[model samples]
Target: MSILATEIWENRFFNGQWAVAEKNYAVTEVATGDQLGVMGYAQPSDVEYSAQQAKVAQEKWWALSYQERAQIFENAIQVAIDHKADIIEWLIKESGSIVMKASFETDLAIQALKNAMILPSSVQGSVLPTQNGKLSLAKRLPLGVVGVISPFNFPLYLAIRAVAPALALGNAVVLKPDERTAVCSGFVIARIFELAGLPKGLLHVLPGGAEVGEALVNDPNIASIQFTGSTEVGRIIGAGAGRTLKKVSLELGGKNSLLILDDADIELASQNIAWGVFLHSGQICMTSGKILIHQSIFEKVKQRVVEKVQQLKMGNPMDPSVNIGPLINQRQCQRVEGLVQSAITAGAKLEVGGKANGVFFEPTVLSQVTQDNPIFEQEIFGPVAVLMPFATDEEAIALANMGDYGLSAGIITSNVSHGMQVAQSLKVGLLHINDQTVNDEILNPFGGFGASGNGTRIGGPANVDEFTQWQWMTIQAQAPNYPF
Candidate 1:
């Protein structure tokens, strides 16, 4: 039975209903390069319509009581839970996520939706102290209509990371999911909300390419924009949002680093870091592309990394045994190949795995990578890892911070105190002590610094702040005497 043969598999949802697109875009499976499904390519008019409908629905959605909003989210969570198997199937087929990755992401998405239930009750106004017996208070209000642009990687998790919060905070959402994972991210997401009783026009899902994304972003009715994708595209959205004076939040690119201190357990670091680099074939934004190892244990760590890479099984995502799956598309596979080749030309040693077959690229490891190498600077978002040695703690920190990206960084050390110290010195927004760079929790603020993104964080209680605005209210207990 094909996953896409069903009516709910490849369609657009708008105004609380589903419709097929006039033109169908064929979706290819990353592993086999076969037609997995066909998704509707939303037209510019459709995008505009989503925005207009969202605006019309925002008022009514906002008027709902917090309990009502929370109930909807609660129902939505149940819907996600009920459709878990289908979501996982679509994730594997469309996003090329291995079993563990698909399952983890599905659970994360469900948890995010469940955690968002806190928003309705947790969102509170602040009472400010005023002088001369004046009453001042500030209320956190929804941003009206939130425009969410999500990436193909971790489609369900990333989409709901924004959508759940925006809807929970009383704002209508217009979601533009990446075309590659339209089935899971677009249609399934809409179905979940629809079944959860989200009102008509309050939630819209349009899956298309760049034109559809641009239309959604440029829509004047969209009150704010939330995006997760490459840093280059994030820059454009940031600039456009700036010109329009619209509030925006971005979770962008990362060439994150993983540092192995001299006292680290090489075997454990290798075992854990392999998951970081190879999970989803390194498609995650926080996947560590660079590794800085202390010169003392550099050789041991490098050998262990090679061994770990060798252990990864790349094949169909549905197979429980496969650890690494295919990249999202052939272009990305080629880009990873090109980056690895460029590094090799620059004198970096390819320790293991550097070949690409169809959409599947071997999990590669490179050593002696210099700062001049493209892999050292550019984000090769594939199952490729680069290892470099540093003589001292300062040198390692310098190498880790010597990049345009500062999204996430990891410090692996036996000494907890030392790891904490190193973590504090790093420039990235999120740091993991004795863990991989690719770490996320629904209850924590997740985002990056510098070229990685604007400092605005998402998730946790911060999401409410990002998707809402502060409005001040004042009352005069007594009329003030003024000379007019």
Candidate 2:
């Protein structure tokens, strides 16, 4: 058993209070397989109870002025700032994130909260031209309660990515953080909001596995759903939300492409590509799975990338010098290993590290990956990347679009005009110029195209659209005459 496991898992956050669960499940560290602690296991009935409480709390919360709601979110920023070090430590232990990656996630979550605070001022409605003696206006209203399902890879940021905005928009929230990192995200996040003076029942954190997730999705009280995870799981959540006629926002999977045009600066391109593919071991939705290099620069770029991967330090994430960390679990490590082995069996050449020891996978690079290989077509959520040569600009774009997922894509070119043109042609919701695919901003619209997500975006002023409904109101002193 992990020493921290018993200490951390003694209680679970429920309806803004720390309490024991009906059952407990063990959480282990990925690198050493040591018990970190046991977290609460929420049953289906607990899901129903949470939804009912959220609905009740939302009525009172929604009645407050937008400025009032914004003030509460502003308080959250201070809470996050004050607890930064502790939260980062929890993230590293619970999610197997390196020191830098953990710090980045914690900072991003705080920034998102700040962005959420400002968004209420932007949630404005419009007045329509009147044909009759009537006052007409279209105003946005909260969707009542929101259900947030976040992944373990970015347990804190992904959860707050939706939760902060939903709260700002006057809706209550029921959050289901991934089972693996529930202690930090579930318990600690609830503490952050409570410390910020959010009303009880307005936000409920349920740290659970698939059963809890399924129950939350099926509950009638949840008005909308926001999910970030694998495309396979997103599909199920989307379908369930559809059946319920509930609004759904999905930030799903991605096989993002990093295009190295012939005119690109080799050194700069290699550096960005290395960061994009190896950051957090490439467990992010926007991580570049495919490195599409111009045929003229393929060998040069590949050599630099392989050299960069070789230099990356892979060990305990707690070490500031370690550039890479373990996968979320043994299963993920095995999956990544299996994919690398299968890719090699299908004739792909492994140029660098392709092995796993315990839960740690070495930074791996592959060449000669064919279209038929899964590694080329799917999201290999690991520190693994494949380099492929493209003969022409059209071929490069074609290769980038070959996959069904298109959350993010980027091009590196010295020519700004060419980069802009290619960026316009790409189908992803987010496009980068002279940068890698791994980029995000709190105030920018964040989502993807096709299998990557639904059309709804989750960040910036657009957040209001995902968590609220537009209702047009008209009032007339005298009833208007109909055609009759």
Can you list the residue pairs that collide in candidate 2? Answer: 5-36, 5-37
lDDT string, candidate 1, 202-226, tens digits: 9988887788777777888988999
Model 1 — TM-score against the truth? Answer: 0.96
- RMSD, one per candidate, in order: 1.8, 2.3
**TM-score for predicted model 2 compared with the true structure:** 0.96
> Best candidate per lDDT, number?
2
* Per-structure clash totals for the candidates: 0, 2
lDDT of each: 0.86, 0.87
lDDT of 1: 0.86
Instruction: Give the lDDT of residue 174 in candidate 2.
Output: 92
